[model samples]
Target: MEILSNLALGFSIALSPYTLMLAVLGCFIGTIVGALPGLGPSNGVAILIPITFTMGLDATAALVLLTAVYYGAMYGGRISSILLNIPGDEPALMTTLDGYPMAKNGRPGQALVISGFASFWGALFATVMLALVAPALSRVAYQFGPAEYFALYLLAFSTLGGIASNNQAKAAFASCVGLGISVIGLDNFSGLPRMTGGNLHLMDGVDFLVAIVGLFAVSEVFFFIEKHGKGGAVGVKLNKFRVPWGEIWSTRWTQLRCGVVGFIAGVLPGAGASLGSFLTYMMEKNIAGPEGKFGTGVPKGVAAPEAGNNSAAGGALVPMLTLGVPGSGTTAVLLAVLMTLNITPGPTLFTDRPEVVWGLIASLLIANFVLLAMNVPLVRIFVKVLSVPPALLLPGVTMVSFVGIYSLTGGYFDLLLMILFGIMGYVFRKMDIPTVPVILGILLGSNMEDALRRAMVLSDGEWTYLFSSPIAIGLWIFAVAGFIAPVYFRNKIRKPQAVTD
Candidate 1:
């Protein structure tokens, strides 16, 4: 009954003309950002944060708008993945595996429609789960100590390396690189620079936004030039937009299963949508038996990852809202926005600022519907984005990235940093070393370090304190098991197939 009342209050605020309009506008902008390669939800929200301040809206409305953009961007990323074989963002990478193949087979319209529906189901299911489960989960999270938090972070790193890539060594190396970057600034405990190279800007550590833009947007430009030459571009044909209702219906079980898996993954810190999508795709491949032509553009291929990523997006918000801990890069930005507004997230956020919490929840539900409605009829228009020449598109993307990063820091140094990372990203791509783990490492490194430091302080440097709590021990056990489970299961599954062959 209380939940109903809270939801009613949320709807009342979310349905207001101003808030509703912002939601629609956010969805529109997010789709465009997501469709464009390199500029993702993090960039979209980070770039727009200043504009939100200038609009003079209250905290609730500003958050509603930004959160909508986040959700919209997730929906938009599939556009390029399916149409052009370019992932709009890291999370959409898996989509390219089957999405491009499906489009190439001349089911472009069906592919788009199927992904749209899958994204819708994923977002809707996760949002509903957020509404129902967050309160209870928040209560559990409230009991966490520094040790528990550190253990949880370890779990994230352990599971992430295996799940993010087939090459655990590369992932671990990338994660270590990210951790090294995270420690570049002044140490909080000792008040000394760790790896600043004595530069002034290095004293503040690397800006997350700067790194993200360089690694994704700027690196993409380099790859685009290399792959397509100066003037070449991939051309896509658009058939009449049609919903494959029958095909989508047949994959309902896959969608549901993947959605659940994605939501659970999202709820774990640092797991993010990319991991969720990858895990679900692998799961579906295993379950679909011999007939699942996953790599050849199967409908379920598109559906599973799309659902998982969107659901993971929704799940990422849970920890951010309830525990004041962001599960992904984008949510980290959202957390900063919340802090800037003087609205601290965590358990008290529910009681103290019911309006903001519930209103944001309500807006998410509305935004999902908005994205679905907009995507279906307007997909043909989105597909047209693929027709733009690389020479033109690449330059435009570079300009947008520069403007967005400059707007945040107002420094040329950051611009140079962007280019440097861009080159590094390009090199990493060429070497087949995954860059997502690098980003994840940077994102989670500081938090893990802080948690570990705090735990040691509490225990007078006793290492056993890290596993003092049942929760902490359980998390450590899971971390070790998760790291080994994938390799074990892969071998088990493949061995039987080899025998049959």
Candidate 2:
């Protein structure tokens, strides 16, 4: 009954004229961003976050807009895969296997319509699950103290290396680099600067927004320019876009099963949409056996992965809203946003800022319907967005990154640091080091350190206290297993026509 009232409160905020308009605008922009190759939900949110800060939006409005963008990008990722045989982002890779084949059969519009329907059902299912699960999880987190929190942070990093990166060694290196960056400011315990090099801007450490823009948005700009504006090729133009209501009806079971698989995957702390899509595709393929014709562009093949990835995207929000641990790279960016707004995520968040949490939830529900309505009939407009040259699009994105970060901070040193981080990001990309863990480290490092310090103070400097609680012990075990489990599965997980990030 209380949850019902809370949801009603949420709907009231989400239905407001200002919030509804932002949701529509965010969905439109997010679809365009997702149609562009390489800028997935993570980059979409990061690029726009600084702008929200600059605009000085209230926390609820900012969250509503950005979350709309996140959900919209998940829907938009399929546009390129169905029509162009090019995945707009990593999770959309599986869509190409069956989607492109369907497109080649002169049914480009059918492939798209099917995928859109799958995306809607899958996301809707996960959103329902998230609503049911996050409050319970937050209640459990109320028992956590310093030892448990430090261990939770450790689990977050270890899981990222194990599940997010193909190479754990490189991910560890990136984690260390990010932690190093986090410690550059004044140390509260010592009351002295640690690694500031006597520079004034270093006093507050690296701003999360600046680092995010540099690593994601600016570096992407450099990559686009270097590749000579060849982000996507529309190999199969749509001759006609017809709604496939029968196809949608046929794959209802496939969507339900994939939604379940993807939502569970998303709720897990490091297994993201990539794994969800792959697992669901394989699950459907196995269920169909020899006659399913999954690889040759069957409708179920198009449905399975689309449902899985989009549902997983929604599922990834559960942990971020509950325990402050991001379940995916994009959720990590959203975590940065919440922190920047001075809204610490944990058990109290629901009680302390129910409006923000409930409003964002309501907005996601609204955005899902908005995306379905817009995508079903108007997908042709998003497909045309692919024709816009990366050369023209990237510079404007870069300018936003520069201008947004500067306006928010007003620090010349931050601009220079951003450029340096951009260069560093390019180098990291060249080296095949995943940048997500680095961002996670910066977001969680200080809090982890504080937890450790508090634990030590309570335990009188005893190391054993770090593992004193059952939650702490479980987190340690989970962290270790999370890192090792990926190694065993890394060889078996296939990436058919996988696009490099």
Candidate 3:
């Protein structure tokens, strides 16, 4: 009842003309970015973040727009995966397994409709879960101690490394690198500079959004170069896109089951939507036995993983919102955004700022419906978006990045710094190193340092106190496992196609 009342209040706020406009706009832009290969939700959010700041909109409104974009991108990513056999992100990789096949069979529009519907279902379920459970979950985070936090961070990195990337060493190294970079600016506790190298820009530390743009967006330019002259795929005519309503409703059970699977998969550390989808597919295959064609354009296979991944996308939000931890690369970006807004999203968020919480929840509900409508009737427009020349599109995107960053601080140094980071991003891609860890490092670094310092303060400098709590111990174990597990799975898990250029 309280949840309902709170949600009603949230709807009141979310539906206000201003917030509503932002939500619609966010969904529209988010879908475009999501549909583009190499520019996943994180990059999309990062690029637009500066623009929102420049607008000087209310914090909540900005968040509403950005988050809408996040979900929208999630909604749009399936387009490329289905039509081109190239996933917009790793999570969408599983979608391609069946989605591309479906497109190849002349059902690109159908495959898109199925995936869009699944995204809606998953997102709807997640919104409900968040509304009902976030406050309670936040209370759990409040009880955490430094030891527990350290463990939590450890678990986050290790689990992420173990699961997100194929090479555990590379992942762990990435984790280490991220943590180290987080320590770069001034030492909060000691009030001394450690790694700034006397550059004033170094004192402010790295801007996470800048880092994200470089890694995901700029790196994508390199990837685009790899396949420069390749034309779009055939067999994906977009004339008909009405949902096969009877077919979808008939598979309600599959939708429900996949939603649950995706949610659970998202909650677990190191697991993401890709894993959720893959697992769901295997489950469906087993359940149907030999009778089901399973992978050969079967509705269930597409429905299950699509629902699972989208649900996982929503589920990943739980830890980020309730626990201040991100379960995937994209949510890690969201975490950074929350910090920029000065609204830490965790247990305290529910009690201290219900408006942001409830408003976000309400907006998500609306966005899902919007996605269903857009994806079905307006998909042709989105496909047309793909045909826009990259040369023209890239310049506009670049200008947006520059203008957005300038609006944030109005500092020439910041713009220059962004350029430098962009170059660094380009270099990182050439090395085949994942750029997400660096951004993660920048986002988590300061907070982790503060947590460590506070823990020491409470413990009176007793180092052993870091492991005093069971939760803390558990987190450490998880982190270490995250670091090691990737190595264990490297040989077993097949590597996806390497990013090009």
Clashing pairs in 1: none
Backbone N/Cα/C clashes per model: 0, 0, 10
**lDDT, candidate 3, 1-501, per-residue tens:** 788889897899899988998999999998898887667787788888877777777777987898899888878888888887877666677778778888878788888888788878987887777677677778889988766776776677777766666556666676677778778777887789878899888787767777676666665565566668355554366656567777678668888988888888787755666667776767777888878776677677677777887888788888888888887777887787788889887778888898988898898888888887887678778877766666666666777777877778778887776776777777765665656666667778777778888889999999989988877877777677667755766687554432110
Predicted structure with the largest lDDT when compared to the true one: 2
Instruction: Show the lowest summed lDDT stretch of 10 residues, model 2.
Output: 492-501
Instruction: Give the range of the ten consecutive residues with the poorest summed lDDT in model 3.
Output: 492-501
Candidate 2 local lDDT, 1-501, one digit each (tens): 878888899999999999999999999988887777868888889989988988889999998889888888889999888887878878888898899999999888899889999999988998888878889999999999999999998888888778777788988898888888888898968878989998887898998778888888888888887888764664787876658788889999999999999999888886678778888999999999989998898999999999999999889899899899888888889999999999999889999999998888888888999999878888888878888777778888888888888888886888998888888888997887878878888888788888999999999999999999999999999999998887987798754322222
The lDDT for every candidate, in the order shown, is: 0.81, 0.86, 0.76
Any idea what lDDT model 3 has? 0.76
Which regions of candidate 3 deviate over 4 angstroms? Answer: 229-231, 427-432, 493-501
User: Cα deviation of 280 in candidate 1 (Å)?
Assistant: 3.9
Best by TM-score: 2
User: Which portions of model 2 show Cα errors greater than 4 Å?
Assistant: 495-501
Task: Determine the C-alpha RMSD for candidate 2 after optimal superposition of all C-alphas.
Answer: 1.6
